[model samples]
Target: MPLCRLAGAGALTLLLLSSTVYAQSSTATGVSRAANPALSANVLYLVGKATRHDALDEPDERHAADADEHGAESPGARVQEFELRMTSFVDPHVKADLTLATHGVSETELEEAFVTTVGLPSNLALKAGKFLGSFGKHNPLHTHRYPFIERPMAHETLFGEEGLNEVGAEVSWLAPTDWYTEIVAGVYNGDNPALFSGEAEEDVAFLGRVRSLVDLNDATTFEVGASGLTGRHEELSARSNVVGADATLKWLPLEAQRHKALTLQIEYLRGDVGGATRHGGQVVARVRVTRRWWVQGSGDWLAGDDPTVRRVRGLIAYVPTEFQALRLQYGATFSGDEDTDHRVALQYNFTIGSHPAHAY
Candidate 1:
């Protein structure tokens, strides 16, 4: 069959399955998520987010691997673009999501789109089409969901084959724990680190992640998680970054309306293969002064036990409301004889058409 015809059929198949599943779940639960036929048909949820990031200096590869051009004279010389994503429920039990995003790159290079539906049973979910591999907590979440405006020094090297989505199947499991525990595992096309789509990368990868949230008390809480991954590419065979763990503990003092939620979060990762060893740690602290106002700051430094590359980064964010925030970031790195360059970015985040998640 023609490729276009094939793609169309796949999309139709997912939509039909989603509709069938939603009806079954809603009828069983008798949950009134909608009031009328129209409302019921549109019982799906939608979320929209916007962000702006400015690289402060030349894009230098040494410090921020993703910032290969960091300190150039005109950091903003490239173009700016927009992204919009939609997710809706076809039935009470199934949700379909679509993402269409493009920016800066010439119009000729706009990214294609992908849609997938999730089924519920055994607390198991299946994903097809294109999306990101579930590596870290941050990988699956929209950037707006990040606590800081930007990722840490090591994010560039391992976030993606190049730095985006890919075709894959992902399965998720929610362990029946008092606290929330989630695990996501998947395999993808592993396309090279360039075009964000395709069918081959020579070999597939084995990826897995486990996350847990622990509530210590009414005023104290903690979260811990870890991930394991391995993959192969050309000259870079048997690449892996294993055993990364992170935890955040918070101590809250509540008196009158005046409140403080002081949290300390730390993450550690170590590994290397085929000339790439990624070991780094990050420390971050956040302080909330009001119900809707908060301040946060973090510093990160990373060095592969090899000691040939060292990176440093600083992050800050101010949230004025549940739906809006302002963020800033700066980073620098030392790589052998390479130039030490700096990067700076500013971003604004807001949800356009959806209700807040867990926090709300």
Candidate 2:
């Protein structure tokens, strides 16, 4: 069957299963409705314009084309994405999560469907099924959770539009240390055309990461992480290796945690493909101005093998409540031998039902 149909059927089945669970839990003695999966929907609407339409195209043109074919409007105004998410414990020892997403009015797609072990011995955990890989900090964020209007240029250039999401299994261990520390390893089907595309059983991609966190003071904390991946590169017809490092510093005053805060994040990535090396990175700073207002700025750069690309962006956001937000952003991109592109965007985001908190 077609992929869209299959995804739709899977979503329907999950919805029915949730309903059945709710009915059973409501009727059973001493059982709470919480036994049913938590369901949530998120929507993002965008209205924006760019100096050059070609430069404004999403990194994955194929997926954008699918949205266009489904009668989505031109780039200036459209529903950026609509996502339905379900999360719940499958039993005492396992948990499941599913995310179905549609871009514009495009066909629904299964973005993620994964199961994770709830408890294990020795601070170890296991996860399986199709999910986003725990790559650098930025690669794991969902669209609505992005601090800026769009992804950094470096990330889009290396990981395509969707980042490193794939069918995979992962194991993670939390160390018994004073500060928070974790080690993770995973293997995935090497099928991302932009970077990896091996088809054989043995031609899989491997990833490893180590992350640690420390509290600098009463109101400050710091986190650092390093990640490495090796896989078969289809375009180069050879093996490729990518390594990344990231750091984040944040401050939130105890007495004014809601009204004031600051965060600084930096990430660097280096990739070796076919004897050539490329380097990319981004720096971002964000400040909470008031209880419901925020300001953010970021710079991104990429170099090696191709013309260097740089981007700068700034935005201000007003989040009236936990469920809705409005933001206006301006960005400029410069590339060697190409005309600079300036863009402005206004985005509206809203969510309904029970939504999980994002990672810190």
Candidate 3:
């Protein structure tokens, strides 16, 4: 059979399967979700194929060792995640939130469990528990909030594939500056896979971030931030330092604030691992063509001791409502002195209840 014909058949099958699953799940629990309080679930289904050496399925050898230690798997077509989320106000002074993620069929993990202060003096708030580090914008963003299906190569190389998260405590403050400014500092147990795997009481990682937003006009806005992390690499028994900067610009017409918008975002990260420095960057732009249609493109570059890898990606998404989305993405990656790979992915994301808002 022709490749195009085969691809078409596969696409049709996936669409049918996804629709059936969604309908059944909705019908089975519609009443329960409607009656429940502070509980919700989001399911992400992804299907894809790779042409030539599937780098995603066979990540760099260096990181493969680390993933093996934690039983992480390579990229593939599967139920990416079924996230059960719970949020509630514990009392007058505190709020609690937790996310439990089920990957594939058997792997279930506590993705995030944290509590935050409801009200604090001096424009300050405190957070404690296990959560993703606030080292950079990308590190803190969940998969569903990502513009692209895959994370930037910088995250894969500097931190583990899952970025960086640990049992930690954070203190954040809103500055009194004219522009919207905030600063955050966190200390973690340094138990991430490759970045920091030390569990000793004294072995810890410290990170800080400063972010500011400016409104250029009623329709335009710009935000920029800097972040840094210092940690111990127990595997290598060396000191690790990572520094990053990110910026985003957004525009929305006053008349079509709900339907049309444009966003440009970019981030750069540099890491020093035992004196060996590596750097990578990614830039993405998204344009909303209509109330339910959007297109996004991204470019990624990673260079260091290994062969430099570059990738270009484009995505088109349709959001029928606020709770569901369908997206298609195509990407091509090229590594110097290595075979280039092309891939395509289709994803469906749906929420079943009153989900909490994502962080800015």
Q: Against the true structure, whose TM-score is highest?
A: 2
**What ranking emerges by TM-score with the best candidate at the front?**
2, 3, 1
202-305 per-residue lDDT for model 1 (tens digits):
66766678888877877777888887765554444445444567887877754622356787888776545455566766677777766656676666655664
Off by over 4 Å in 1: 1-73, 76-81, 91-93, 105-119, 160-164, 192-202, 237-242, 250-260, 305-316, 328-345, 356-360
Clashes of 3: 0
TM-score of each: 0.66, 0.86, 0.85
Question: Using alpha carbons, what is the TM-score of model 1?
Answer: 0.66
Ranked by TM-score, the better of candidates 1 and 3 is 3
Better of 2 and 3 by lDDT: 2
**In candidate 3, which residue pairs clash?**
none
**Best-matching candidate per lDDT:** 2
Question: Model 2: per-residue lDDT, tens digit, 1-360?
Answer: 699999999999999988887677545546776578999999999999778655444533655564357534365778888999999999999999999998777567888999999878999999998888888898877789988977776676667666788788999999999999999999999766556753555568999999999999989999999999889887677987889999999999999978999999999998776677778899999999999999999998888877888889999999988799999999898878889988889999999999578566
Better model by TM-score, 2 or 3?
A: 2
What order do candidates take by lDDT, descending?
A: 2, 3, 1
lDDT of 2 at 135: 86
Q: Candidate 1, residue 290: CA error in Å?
A: 2.6
> How does model 1 fare in lDDT?
0.56
Per-residue lDDT of model 3, residues 1-360, tens digit only? 699999999999999988876767556646335434398898988887777534553255766664444434444667877889888887799888899988665778899999999879999999999988887678887778878988898887788766787899999999998999999999989887657654766779999999999999999989999999998888788988999999999998899976998999999999888777889989999999999999999998888888788999999999998799999999999988777888888999999887566543
